[model samples]
Target chain A: MSMRALTGLKPIPPSEITPREVFLDRRRFLAGATAAAAGLGTAAPALAEEMAMKLPAARNAAFSTTDAPTAKKIITGYNNFYEFGMGKSDPAASASKMSVRPWTIEIGGAVEKPRTIGIEEVMRLPLEERVYRFRCVEAWSMVAPWIGVEFNKLAALVGPTSKAKYVRFTSVVQPSVMSGVRAEVIDFPYVEGLRIDEAMHPLTILAVGLYGETLPNQNGAPVRVIVPWKYGFKSAKSIVRIDFVEDQPRSTWMKLQPSEYGFYSNVNPAVDHPRWSQARERRLPDFFASTPTLPFNGYADQVASLYAGMDLKKFF
Target chain B: MRSARAADGRFAWATSDPVRALKPLVFLLCLAPALLLVHDVLYDPEALGANPAETIEHVTGDRSMQFLLGTLAITPLRRITGWGKLIRFRRMLGLFAFFYGVLHLAAYIAFDHYFDVPAILADIVKRPFVTVGFAALVLMTPLAVTSTAGWIRRLGAQNWSRLHKAVYAIAVLGVLHYWWLVKRDLTWPMIYGAILAVLLGWRVWNETLGRQRRRPARVRARAEPGPAE
Candidate 1:
């Protein structure tokens, strides 16, 4: 109890009037960001189970976007999950080939208590729906209500040692099912990383589902990172390993093209991909129209301080 | 009488009746892709998926390349099938390539850059992918314009053959444009490249050793030398 308060991860009473779940929920995030009767013992394989079991999460409007959410059909059908295939619709079509059951994320490296956490155990932490503006590096945007726990709460289980400077996230490489993995499009076991501060940011979450349902196979079922302020690739999908490390890890995109993709790929319109302008993005369903892209993907007030004094152009 | 009838059967389709019958079908086949694309934009846009602008760009661009390749294919296919009049549809195929290439360009200009001239120009100059794609379209214009019988008469058949040979270069440029733009998977572009390679390689081989190859001596003389290509 003292250690949780010492680390500043202790859950305080919600708005000075504790919700029943807030006081009872030991794993509730700090700052009272979300409260829910987080459940456990809901077994895996969302694909096999037909997603009949709903993991009800509170719609935390505090973290939600005022903008309308993209339709679930479009969200599920249109994707950039290169693991399944390169085409936009390939993921949704072929992701059913892989099963999302018996999944476990290994937590280790530069942490005091390293342990393997199952999907069910990870979902035991309070769940909440956050409608976030998801900006992809390919210059597309979507507002999705993602359900998950704040990453800091998950990290709170084993406090990082003083040596930890960065966090590396690695996605599962299902070569047997993933067409890209079999073809070796870039590399398997896609890796992404974040600075210690960015990983611990309140906005960073490990999303398990979206739109009041367990994530479809296409959307990286079981668990995936949702870093709203950064480019979508910065949020690794189907994450298998979370390693708190001393040195910054080279992400898959960064390894593929260092000049184009940097470690801190925050959504900045000013910094453009050499091939195209990032100044504006074409929102889905509106083919010819484009809207001006906001700096830090409109989360500057929440995340801009993370990059203070650092030249974004250089890092980007 | 039986031998004469067999000979007539061989050359009959190459002449008016079947060629005339097939022209409209091929023409419709060529126009179908564009019509479907426009229909999707106007009516059933969901068929184009989430990124319809990008989808439009890809559909128009891919169809352009397909038509360009089909145009190139006419010569080799005519030679192989000994179909003398197959060459008549070459102009139509080339024109369709240009038409779709124009649509592809319009998609990029209207959707991608939103008619921002400076941005479009800057992108065309700065990115090698855009540069090659634009060059392919620019090079295709002269061939499409000179495809008429009047222009053929004005330029002479020999000179027109030399000018139209630029189709090979345009094909290469089209393939390179696709190759350079893809982020990771080179599978489709590589397939296109292989087809282009085979076509170009066959041309090189034909130029080097085609005189000895079996071509039905009558068709050989009628086809003339490389100058009439």
Candidate 2:
């Protein structure tokens, strides 16, 4: 396919999309991709045996039901910038080196059902997958097919009360496991939080895998939270704990420098970071063409109400 | 000075001093760090792993600032100790610092900006970090020019010393330039800042106490002088 064909996916309206619309759109794309792959002649039948068989349920909807290499390429190549160690390409190499086997997640804090679950148990959540454009505060972005479950189902199991105001996510902190921690470049136990409402949004996900296979460790294997509206950093990686607290929890970036990283790090263009512009972001895949970064990372329809009556520029 | 040179030429037949030749060799020794940096640019995978072009510029810039601070500290350190030989090495270190600084500025111009003059001008005006770094580079220019023996002789000792004190200003700007560039980490920049502070503090103390303690004798000798020059 031509590069122009790849770039033809226009920018989605920031405040007009719905979960139903996104779900339907992804279904259509996956269906068309499967039909295209099937027509690849004898090569498809020949390569089917050589290619590793992926579980149908675990495949990201964007790549699921399709044997197309293009779908797999997009899923792997286009992803959150943080997975690359805060650089654009760091994830592609460093993440590949990471091992994502025999993992368990410790789920504790305000949940009544506080328990340690195996990676397999976490993967078995009622699945729903969606394609999201993740925008980073560093002015780079990616579109990826995230396969996971509705976060509210996980939260509902936890038994959140009226007292619970936020859900703080913590990634695994062992320096050996996450090499980025060893440098002391950033304070560790990487944290991100969502106000109780945002945590319970249907679009918010707890992803276990992608591209029709178990999540590679570089992509927050086993399980990671995906808050589509917030900047990509808000999607905590390699999760170890989920805390339901009564107040807003402290995040890693905010604890390091509160002024630069506001708690509500929603993707708003008007609020420029002290060091760089927020007005535009370089989209991965189309690395040469930068487009205007949308507010709420173009998830305003699902999340705008969560910040009602609050000024994004001030909060940001 | 001419008679001394004529006498030295006549005596040249009497001896060939290898010590004089070693001075140039020592000058080459002072370039070890810059040469090592170029070596790192070729071998260090991490240096160019992210944005190869931008990372190259940052490494060059960091080495430049470090050498500049090292060169500036030499005078105060030499005077405090009785290490007069430090004098022979000062000019070489100062020139290397300037050479790296030139490379730092050139990379920013060529790779970072691709010689986009308008963007660079805007950055200098709009960004605090760029403004401080650019100002330091500008201040370093004149000091590098008057580094030669000919310019020192032409400018006179008194004027040369005063003009070259601009290195102190550049040191301060360099520290500030690093401090403002960090996102969340302050440890590295703060360490550099603390060292620069102590070095500059030594210079200030030396100017007030070391120079003043000797000034009275000179005053007295001049007062007792019979005729004015």
Candidate 3:
């Protein structure tokens, strides 16, 4: 195989790929039958089950990267959904109470066509799997296979007026349901925003599913934005509203600590966080080794032009 | 067995042999956390989850704080229970606190920064949390070194006692370091703060009462000057 193939840059055609059912069956056979046949090995079946879930290859060749996706367990289990709690593992345990069904998102503010769209209608929009690298501001990263539509499609539907320079997202804020709200850890109804061009960027997506299944609540169920070039918090989860505005919107983290979390939180290795250096990130499930972080989280080739003249250090 | 009497004429455990007998058990108890971490590193690294280095660092740091608080509680506990023997374990507990604190600092230097002194120094200078934590560790070094009987004798009881009062400042810095380190949740730090408040409050109460009791004697001494003056 070529280096590109080994690096996962080359896209395999759909027909050449193994079917999901066949793959799962092989996994089950290896887990159940092979383990028993191999004289009752203790760890084999458990390890196989732990590594069972795998998302289908990205259909959009443009979005596919040379990075392997993080383990499904790590992607689902380790999360930073502050609406549930502050601890990374708290969300997976506490987010089960969240009800995403019958959800509707209201899009308004400087948009010519203001309207409310149901979750079902949004889900029906053409979905494509995009494997993208996710970089968190806390110096951790993961490669996630997100299944969703481009934010441009959503923007096109909303019909933003010329005055709309930024797109703001708001998360669901039912304090009765979300226990983390009681603590007031952050301003409730967690808000995040993106520049109009950044929102319409081809790479920006509103993800509904991951790992070939409906998104787990801990991993932001229903719908959430995914901006590959920005910090993970910029991808607000369980979105309830999207508004187009002229002024730069205040993000939750930026509101809490303006110095630490800037509005344009693009992943820049050179701009170190006030607390620690961002030169390297600890890739999940591999705790011992930390890989050097890349500028724009290794997505600079596609998005670097957006900030051609501006200074990233000042903006960051 | 001969029994020692407290100032109030109460029998104290310091004269009993059981206090010395329990020293080994207390020593093992102090060593338990480090042993558990070593075992996890060797046999089941996954027990610490995906970030074992972080886990180790957090555990050691937390243990150091707990032991520091435990050391502070010895006086109050000994006074309340009339267990003079408790004072014997105070040095051991204090040494354990210093031991865990050093380990915590070692984990940050070795694992987190990979011994990159420049980067570590930069963090210490820039980050308030790291700054206070580093200061607390530095303050603890002298206390730990001068804890020996020889050093205490050389310094004299009054000077030794005055110098070791720095532990109170160390505890405050330690709590502040923890409080500043957390981004959102202040639950653990708040609990530590409450404990530190009570411990310090107890000392203040005792000192005030001591001053009140001594004031009358001081006034009488001034009123009736003796020939020695």
What would the per-residue lDDT of candidate 2 be over residues A72-108, giving only the tens digit for each residue?
Answer: 5544534443423544445554664344444577767
For A110-186, candidate 3 gives per-residue lDDT tens digits of: 99899998776676577889889999998888899888899999878879999999999999987876778987888
**Candidate 2 docking category?**
incorrect
Which structure is stronger by DockQ: 1 or 2? 1
Greater TM-score among 2 and 3 belongs to: 3
Model 3: colliding residue pairs: none
User: Chain A TM-scores, one per candidate?
Assistant: 0.84, 0.74, 0.82
In model 1, the runs with Cα more than 4 Å from the true position are A1-49, B1-16, B212-229
Candidate 2 colliding pairs = A59-A212, A84-A90, A84-A91
Residue A192, model 1: Cα distance from true site in angstroms: 0.8
- Candidate achieving the largest DockQ: 1
Note the Cα lDDT for every prediction shown. 0.84, 0.68, 0.84
Model 2 ranges with Cα > 4 A deviation: A1-116, A126-135, A139-150, A156-165, A173-190, A201-203, A209-222, A280-294, A298-309, B1-47, B76-92, B95-99, B102-127, B208-229
Candidate 1 docking DockQ: 0.50
For each candidate, give the interface RMSD after superposing the true interface residues on Cα.
1.2, 5.6, 2.2
TM-score (all chains, Cα) for each model: 0.85, 0.64, 0.82
Which runs of model 3 end up more than 4 angstroms from their true locations? A1-57, B1-15, B213-229
